[model samples]
Target: MRDDSTRNTIIFVVCSLALLLLYQVFILEPAAQRRQAEAARKPAAASNTTAGPVAGTLPGVAAPAQVRVVTRQEAAAASPRVTIDTPALQGSISLKGARFDDLFLKQYRETVDPNSPPVELLRPEGARHAWFAEFGWTGANVPGLPNANTLWTVTQGSTLTPTAPLSLQYVSPAGLTFTRQIAIDARFMFTVTDTVANTGAAPVSLAPYASVQRQGAPAHVGHSQIVHEGAIGWLGDELRLIKYSKWAKDGGMELPSRGGWTGITDMYWLAALIPSQSENVRGAFRVTKAGETNIFEANYVGALRQIPVGKQVTETTRFFAGAKTVPVLKGYEKQFDVPNLNWAVDWGRLRLLTQPIFSFLEFIYRHVGNFGLAILGLTVVVRLLFFPLANKQYESMTKMKKLQPQMEELRARFKEDPAKQQQEIMALYQREKVNPIAGCLPLLLQIPVFFALYKVLSVTIEMRHAPFMGWIKDLSARDPTTIWNLFGLIPWNPASTPLIGQILDTTLHLGVLPLAYGFTMWLTTAMSPPVGDPMQQRIFKLMPLLFMFIMAPFAVGLLIYWTWSNVLTILQQYVIMRRLKVDNPVDQFIARFTGKSRAA
Candidate 1:
């Protein structure tokens, strides 16, 4: 009988572990792979691809035939002139109109990318149409410039057409003239420089202003979201006029509302550089006014800097227009700082820890080439590191399980007096030196790590559309194969279901993995002692079903992690049960620290 009991125990443990490992690899891992694959299939979902110049489209400037790609010096020597045509001042609309027409425009749509780091872009639908022409400079990269900085001068009457050839001419006061060629090769980055020359004798007071009216309804920004300008600031509906950061008595109010444009500062989703005094200020500023036309202006206050007549002062304004990816943005360095990366939790201390975790996950993806294996390896490392703590917990649970009969007797004896029952239980606990909550320590330690990893797996771009084995295509979405149909009547079988029929159907055929997950959780719970009163036990019995429901929609990778962790814990418990001898409370108090069994 003893041998039979041992064999049964071994069988149970092996079956449970096998189920967990299989579910993780077969179901969870594949689910994650599916999610990653779907995301990778979409071009706009890639951060690097989206940030690069939209291939095949340039606003304002027409594509040149037989494009000449040469060094900055060569392009400068061949400088071409681009003329912006201003029509008869019609109605209230400015003659500077920018139109964005490109096939790549679809890449800007809202969707999660597994390859690109996540970022928050706070503009409305105006981004849908590329800026063609406006009164202000377009904020992006300019072609043919060594550094992504250049200004275009509208020769007043020349109409800018898509087919017309354009050129850039840089005229220096020392007669150092340079010309640059431009072309459209499926993608183009044009930077608009606005240098306002102070041709007037007096110091002209100028506060550069630009606005764009929304042709459609406003976009949504959630309540939890906040716009930070060095410090946190709320993004109000109407025009939000914020002053630049300044040096104050109490250190520096990083984002303070100051008078007049004196220094450049970055606000939520926007950056601007203001000159101490405008001579010919050349820089781009994004403005959102009450009207519909979205206008971005760059102005240079030229010769307005308290300069004597005939001594011309030039303030060169530079704008960067291109992709917001790391490489392209790095070219323009300090100028292009777009806040898009989503940190797990916004708390300063937690964010520090969370960011590195995400960075590490990204690194692992590059090396190991599989996120599923990465998660498993990470879990194993964490568990091994905390083995000592886990051991302590398992020993405590073993002792408690052995004393269950004594505990039940104590409850029965004090059944009439609730206070007496509690006192007896405490006394018993003291005698046994057992801590009920000690088992919770391991779980408590793992919660934060688990949550942080969860965030990384959900948001990291590298894991998107990444493959594991088969069937599963995306890690971020629910399992595509569902087991049941409407009213749980028909089995929506993946193998038998036709492709066209499956496409129209919302239900997916349920598979074995989810069922295995549910069964393992139930068995793990069954192997443990009951807690709380009858009501709690009843609720506890429903836990496995509840967990399966909750987890059904989660990425297969997460389910794999959870299932595998449980399996390891079960094995650990089994070892503790066999090796760590627990004294029968009816017999005597055996010293648990020494592992010696004593007789009553």
Candidate 2:
């Protein structure tokens, strides 16, 4: 009886533990995930004003005494108007009614009027100097919603000032709510707190959306741009261009419609205009599962809400808006998605190896105060760090070239038996203590590094509009310096045939750096082993030209790094060849390096 009781107690304890684990993994986790998703979808609702007649009653014989008293009482009960003092910033504006125009733009001007309608009340004042603004919809009644009416009232409530360290409460039509405020530290960064609540009797279902429409261009034609920390995507009328990112598709999906456009980052910023009612409105949507959340931007136009009668649900979210400036974006570390915007470095496994290169370039920028020089410094540092490895590979290749005669003799000796030929070659390699794979390691390691650096230079905003020495104006743009023209009509022409001229212009004339890059590539290949097969030689010879063609349209800063790296490698190889005497007779070279007398 005692043993049975002990066994039952142990079994009960084990069962309870198992049940707890199951609850946490399956039930509690999913519920927590749903709550987080709701947190991210804090929809911005529309504001409302009290209905009233215009002031000054018309010429009436007598006004009701009771009506007059009620009117005065209603006026006294209205919320007092709040005023925002303008800061010292030159482009500063004011906040008053709900104004949507106060939202920031990457490269455009904006304004706001305080005396506009209720919708205009959402318009923010003092936005010109602010990094971002909460505009578009505020209050209870959202525009374009069917069968739903809203009333909004503001009261004399204290708000956390810019200098205040603690959160403050402001009474909206719903109830008192806590709001967090973030200061704009730079030109491109702004953050705001989101306070949403289900101020009704039951649970409220809310779907949040954000949209931006530039005034000057149509949606598709305009450059719809987004930069998260390090990744950037842009949509032109014809193509969607994207930089490097962890995701397979760097450039976003192409749009079918030529007139309207929607852009979104998977878990970050999203924008889309409300679609017309006649169109099949598949509105913008987002979902979160576990800890992963996905945000979508679509051509949907409508509000989503299900507010119960009494229960209150609320949420807070932060927004960072502005240009894709690294320093500015880094300041708002929590708000921006791609801090440092390093996603442009797309080399799959080599991203880690090449990160130091960017760090070195940034360091150089700190001292020299110019981005172009920083690129040059980065090139020098990379070349020096890889010098030993590159030299070792080149030396091995040189030895392979010298062994060619011996290898050919072995091949001839066993020409009829391919298996025997390979065995003999392996034997010869072992006897000579030569490693064929040694020549491949350096090149293999460099491929990914090269690709990653290519991406880094292409999208870094610090290089945008930054000037290098001489005629080069922007490191992030194609090089503009040119010497002479082969054809009078061709722009920035180099001395070559029309076809060759186009190629050269595409590669070399984009900047002086690419020309330097091509020259170094040519030199490096000159010292490399000559391919024995005709087809292989032809292919090898075309590599430099292919690279030049590919790099012509790339940003000049990348070209600078590539060009300098190639030049340094060439110099290193030249010095190694001279010092080791590999350029001379093979027998003598072996005697010196191996300390062995040649077999006579």
Q: Over 4 Å off in model 1, which ranges?
A: 1-349, 485-517, 581-600
* lDDT of candidate 1 over 1-600, digit per residue (tens): 221233244335434544654565456655655654654474243212211221122232222222222332333233333332212101011111221111122222233444553222222212432222222222122222111223433333243332333334444342222232222222222333333333334432223322221111112211111222221111111112222111111221222222112111121122222232212332222232212222222222222234333333333222222222222323333333322212111223345545666556556667888776666666677789789998887777777777778878977888898778777877777898876666656766776676566554554444444455465555544455555553235655444567755433322333444555777787666655555356556655776775565566556666666777777776777667666554333222234655765532
Summarize candidate 2's per-residue lDDT along 225-327 as a digit string, tens digits: 2222212222222223232122123212423321222322211222223122222222222211111111111222224445454443333223333333444
Clashes of 1: 65
Provide the global lDDT of candidate 2 against the true structure. Answer: 0.41
TM-score of each: 0.51, 0.51
Estimate the lDDT of model 1: 0.40
Q: What is the TM-score (0 to 1) of candidate 1?
A: 0.51
